[model samples]
Target chain A: MRRDVFQAIADPTRRAIIGLIAIQAMTPNALAEYFDTTRQAVSKHLQILTECEIVRQEQTGREIYYHFNPGKMKEVADFVEPFRQLWEKRFDQLDHVLRKIKTTKK
Target chain B: MRRDVFQAIADPTRRAIIGLIAIQAMTPNALAEYFDTTRQAVSKHLQILTECEIVRQEQTGREIYYHFNPGKMKEVADFVEPFRQLWEKRFDQLDHVLRKIKTTKK
Candidate 1:
């Protein structure tokens, strides 16, 4: 199943995992070392991330390193772009209003 | 209670509501007309949005209009900014690799 970037990032733990992988690719074992949770739990989070393609695996012979795939995050940025534009416009409007108030005071 | 923009946007319905109000400020009655759901249901979505302050309420005399607050969306954009930069860097690396491959082939 294709999961959205939002679902992939919904959990704080998953978000942390993404953050870790973004800095450096790590094997499942290496990635698990930083977390207090059981390795199995960490593996489960990786599985979810993998399913969403937020994390990609690189194989070198027997070694599998998980790397963060930042491109997948575009889904999120695309979805939020309209909202962001709208927000900036609102801020501009507010700025104009504030300027008008200052001018009136002056 | 303060809510993160991620939580505010998790629901598809809520996202749609945000999109609607972003274009134009609308009252509960007007916003409800677009959905198949009941007026109360639309109001519930509006309530959740209002609580998060993503939809700010403007009261003029007896009229209450819900307007999309674009400022709140910065949380989502901020959280994803690092990931976006990472993605772009990776793309540049890929482009470099592809050019190197072509040069080698030549």
Candidate 2:
């Protein structure tokens, strides 16, 4: 299967992992403590994240710390940025319609 | 599989579909013309997007037009907005470090 940042963040657990590691790096064992799953499952998710380069692993002694690569997340952010304007426009239109309805009611 | 905005936009083709429909509503047949896929394939992608409420279908006579629902994408935007600060901080730190390296070289 192809691994990309989009696929990396598609899972809720992986998003949780990103939220945690974005603050600080963690080993699979440490990350697993926060989830209701096994350490192995956490590791599997980390593996996918690493494959997509969303997280990078660094070996310090026997433990591998997974660090969130903010650069990869920039791609996801960039993808969503353009849509922000579209949504805001829709919201603005809705607000206008609501204001018109309010004037009619008055 | 659970359909969410993230999963809906994971595929490149689906992202393309969103971009095109954002400008103007299009039927699956019209959308397929932009891609190298059959109308049914485009409809399958549209199905996932519709399930996630990222796109809505309006039937005008025999043709069904898919309109991009910008509201669903706001969820995606909200998810990535917090991380924007993190990446910006990292970029700033990188710029600072680069300036220091340049000073040392000089």
Candidate 3:
């Protein structure tokens, strides 16, 4: 099955995993400590993330660590950024209205 | 099943639906025209979008228009913004290194 960033992040656990790995690379066992789930469950999430290239695995000293791939996450950020800008513009307009009201009252 | 913004946007078609309505409120009939699916399928997608409050419906005479809810989308933006900032910082550091290399070469 073809997986994408959206599908990879659809689960809250996956999102948490992304947040954790984005800060630092971690093994599945290490990552499982942060959640109430088992290491196997965390590994499953890691698999989905890896499928989408959202997280990459590196082997060092007989241990594997999952690292965040910001390039893949760029697809998500790019999708949300335009909407964020649109909402910010709306908020600015609302702020302008409030400022105008305050001046009128004064 | 509980739905959130992430779940609402998991599918490519749903994301396209959001992009369309974000520009302007659209009826299910109008939305169906943009897709190869039936109106019922479009309604199902709309139902999921509404369940998560990502899109809201407004009744106008006999028509119900789906409007984008920016507040709900804030959750998504807030989650992605920090990671985007982190990657941007990394990119800036990379730029610094590249500039130093260029300067040394010149």
Interface DockQ per candidate? 0.28, 0.31, 0.25
Which of the CAPRI classes, incorrect, acceptable, medium or high, describes model 3?
Answer: acceptable
TM-score for chain A, candidates 1 onward in order = 0.76, 0.82, 0.78
Superior candidate under DockQ, 2 versus 3: 2
In candidate 1, which residue pairs clash? none
Which lDDT value does model 1 have at A87? 59
Writing each residue's lDDT as its tens digit, candidate 2 over A1-106 gives 8688888888989988887787678999999999899999999999999999889999999999999788888888777766665677664555454344334321
DockQ winner among the candidates?
2
Tell me the spans in candidate 1 whose CA falls farther than 4 Å from its real position. A59-63, A89-106, B60-63, B91-106
> What TM-score does prediction 1 earn?
0.73
Q: How far out, in Å, is residue A64 in model 2?
A: 0.7
- For model 1, residues A4-103, the per-residue Cα lDDT tens digits are 7777787777877887776678888887888888888988989899988999889988978898787888878877765554556655555454444334
- On a 0 to 1 TM-score scale, where does candidate 2 land against the true structure? 0.82
Q: What share of the true interface contacts does candidate 3 keep?
A: 0.46
In candidate 1, what are the lDDT values of residues B1-106, reduced to their tens digit? Answer: 5356676777767777877776678988888888888889989888988888888899978878998777788877767765665666664555454444334321
